[model samples]
Target: MTATAVAASVPVARGYRFELVKLWSQRRVRLLLLTCWAGPALFVAAVSQQSTLPVDTLFGRWMHATGWAGPLVTLGFAGTWALPLLTSVVAGDVFAAEDRLGTWRHLLLAVRSPRRIFAAKVLASLTVIMLLVAGLAAGSTAGGLLTVGNHPLVGLDGHPLAPADAAGTVLLAWICVLAPTLALAAIGLLGSVALGRSPMGLLLPVLVALGLQLAQMMPLPVPVRVALPGYAFIAWNGLFTSPAQLGPLLIGITVSLVWAVTAAGLAYRIFLRRDFTDQAYDGAGRRALTSGLLPLAGVLVVTIAVIVPVTGGPSSGIEQDKVQRSVATAFAHLYRLQTEQLHRPAVTEVQLDTSAACTRGGGRLEPQGPGNDWRCVVSWHLPGVPAAGSATYQLDLTPDGRFMADGDGPKEVNGYFLVRTPAGDAPNPLWQFDGTVALLPTVPKG
Candidate 1:
């Protein structure tokens, strides 16, 4: 059979199958697959044995006890570099492996078309990445249930999630990450096609992922940050929380698709126009890179320019009335919890007044921005204590909508005071009341 006839006989799907089979035959690929399915058990064991949690990562604080937190913790670590590395392993080498082995020239002449080859390579890389993620998710979920137990999971709102619900939520979060993972894979493919070297292709995409993660950490404009892939990576954290905000998740999906598709398109254009005859290491490499990367760079600049000004910042200033209501409601709920700790009378919503004049730095507090200098004059009645007269509270608003307030309360000798002391003892109680209160955003009543 002629080479042309053989190539012509193979459909796009067959080409993809062949590429996948070639990858699967590699010893290194098999080892990577094994690691993907096995690493999570080790992670579970290590985390279980630790006395302290890795609070630096999202969901890390809850990992010690909740069976569901295992996947969340894994995602946090994966967001840093693991996902990028896993997806890049196949993508970085798929195209360059052809060049490195001096097979591109033969394939270029014999293959049905460059477009078919490009599509086949992309499908193969995506299949490997999907498998890697699936293995990790399955391993992590199994290890967590085995070691941590399927207890009810605590959410961001301090509410409890049923074990069944928690399990489903974790699965959804993993699905959410797939978009960005594919984007990372696309990035590696771009590097592979552009540089035509396996090692550089593998390393550059991971470096770019790292750069995007850094950009997320810095105080870039919200639009710019959200436009980046890292934003989607971290946004998955919200799914574990009560009253889960789906807006970020939707935005992340859209942005990730845009980035992956655009990047893959750029890479495809380069591959489609590539000349197999002029296979010089330097000149061809430079041309491939310049042609592939320049358009994407232009797209990024134009995107930033258009989005930054449109999403500069909140223009309609903060309304103190809304702030007062929100703060007071949050305080009432948190105070009820604190009362429970002290074994006191339950505080109800009807017992509290949500009206107050709030101020920041001696000015009418606008609902916008974060500051350490907000004050609210609030009044509430306890069971025995009379109208604990309108007291002045110093409120510190965080950018994430949480507030901590220290209010002027009953006068004390020093620090906190105990309610009941042991008879015949030095009147020292096991618990005491402090004047500080921490408030979270008001969870909507069902």
Candidate 2:
């Protein structure tokens, strides 16, 4: 490279090293890293000793059944608040702390350019965030294997995943989550630069995350919810299903990138224009607000434009046929587990020839959308039994295509919440099952 280029790159490299050293010296950053490495394992150990399981979270009920469930369950819980908090604590405070310490002026007067300093801080913060995520993933995997044992994991689609497949899926799920976590870190950086206060910078990104989560739970349009930042966190659910739904995953990555770039770019603009010499200077006036809002508005418009083409078509809603197929397949797999627990001959899902008829709100509404009032009657055949058996299930579904189905079959078979096994009374897989439905259209099976 030319001499000028080499000279220019030196400042960024030096600034990056300096920023890393600054982060390493902080007590809170060191403590947070340690916690990330140990917290999930500790949680798994505690859960293993308890009789009650966290059945609400995905893979929660299977914590004791498979070592793989520990990381997955922890991932589900982390998406709500832990991830946002983890990213914000560092990125939010990194820039603003310099202001509080009155070190910004000295840093600006140094040989490093403001742009190079900004780049260095961003790189350092992202590196730290990646480490924290890796720590959590490794810790949870180790904890689960040690405490729960490496048993086969039951997939969301009711199929049993071998140990190797389960491990790969768990790893992939964590990797998928990294995109949104980085996006949240970018938001924290934006808050830190704009607010110029350590406390607000740390808290603002977390509050924004909380708000997005609340909006997700509300009854909003499918396209709108998909466009939100929080959707990326839960989109990893698709990974645990058979065939692995990639549509939501793709959309999530796109949405997160848009937010991250927009936030970081605005922060860069503000940092470049601010008069650092003035101690009383603040970046919170009408002009600043307008500048920020205009870019955000444009971002939203672009996001919608991209999302509508992918998710706006008429075939985007829930399909009854798909739901019935998913319910039937899940029931068949769980029924085989139930039979095995009873010491009966195990039946394969195909041999059972399972089929289901589902309806919403007592048949008053179309069973094509998200609602809690859905019901299905699943019927299947068993070898040596002339008469076919049937069971009724109540399904509570969410906008994001996840559902919990409660079966009303005979207690001696699949109705009881718990089934007795040689190990002890474990959760009856057939009693209540969780599964996901693809929102996008798929080719019909013959």
Candidate 3:
């Protein structure tokens, strides 16, 4: 047989495109896509009104507030349930669906090469995941275009990134954030291959994803945290800061890719070797679950052992930031001090803005009405302790609560403070009922 003839006779497998066509023909996948498209927008609308959308940046052109949906989709919520569940909705079921419908045998016989067929399976799954992520970004951008009109975007970092750069950066962040989540999809697909029953594959990854997130949140050391794929995902947030960096993000992407490919290989091997297993577990046409469960359990146990520590120990850079507050007010004074020993900053026109923290909990601080210019921050079930700006400390009551003590330094002295809310015209300030103090040092101790 000539090369061309052999190729023609063997049939060039086009990979995911064929898989995508098969998936698209299914009503479930299509409904999944539609739900993905509409879901985020609706959620954002429910949480926030369309009119009050803040412009993406300071230099940003006047646009509608519903425009917030664009960036909001790129924020934490979108990454949490929206994208992972969306990917899982397909990936979790991709392999198992055929089994449920009794088409696995016909499909396997159609492709002939299990490796090629597995590759196509993976390709289609990834394509679906990628499209859903891209669609989230695109749909919101289009909605923004329709609702507010396309204008230049400013990045989370106040630097004036080009509109394209800003859009691309947000999109890239969303994709990179998927590093940890992809492993869920990969392992789920592996379950699909090995278990032969679709539900067996789908059910496990959802449980694992949810379980792992909880496990990963424990106080662990940095190296331990860095080892887990989940650690890399949240840590990639370093890219959003003023000086954008990708070191951890690059590391994250590398780790996710490694795990995913390895899982893909394992899944392929399972599909290839599945027929040789004992026939006692099922009748002639069905695949067995016993083989799948052990590997799944082993991986789960080992990963949980490693990752639970990673989650339970001291946080990595990002997790530490997320776990703790930066601008805490502590009350400390020099051991001995005279009346004249205390002196506040020469020019103490400090403006403390706790708006970001309050805004985090869906509570808006009005600029000029009752509760206007108030500083209240979200502490319950928040993603991160909001960084407070515009806070200034002038005095510290001595430990004995007798004389006032002022540490000598610049107004932005790098230390902690415990503050007593002096009366301000802005309205009632929520205090600790005692005093709230945190470890917010302007400069980190060496």
The ten-residue window of minimal lDDT in model 3 covers 331-340
Q: Arrange candidates by lDDT, highest first: which order? A: 2, 1, 3
Ranking by TM-score: 2, 1, 3
Candidate 2: lDDT of 226?
77
- Candidate 3 lDDT by residue in tens digits, 1-446: 10111122223357567888988888877887886677655544433444443332221222332253355444555555565576567777777666666765555556555566667877788788877776676666555555554454433321234556556665676667667668777877776666656355667566766665665555334434445555444544445434444544565566566666666666766666655223232222333344444555555456545544433443333212221122121111110011112333221112221121322112342221111122323212112336422322222211111111122222233122322223322111111111211111123322
Backbone collisions counted per model: 4, 0, 20
RMSD of each: 6.8, 3.3, 13.0
Candidate 2 residue runs with Cα over 4 Å from true position:
1-10, 312-316, 420-426
lDDT of 1 at 164: 91
Superposition TM-score, candidate 2 onto the true structure: 0.92
TM per model? 0.74, 0.92, 0.59
RMSD of 2: 3.3
Q: Name model 3 segments beyond 4 Å from true.
A: 1-17, 42-69, 73-75, 144-165, 276-446
Q: How accurate is candidate 3 locally (lDDT)?
A: 0.46
User: lDDT at 252 for candidate 3?
Assistant: 50
lDDT of 1 by residue, 1-446 (tens): 11222345447798899889989998988998898789986787578668776754545656665778787778777767788888778888788888777787676565657777888889988898898888888888877788888987655443457899988888888999988887788888888887786477877668888898777545454556556765678667566544575655666677788778888987887776666655554223667557766766766666555545544442221245545765555455544544555566676756754345678877854444456688777556666666563545666654333345555444321123233322321211111111111112233443
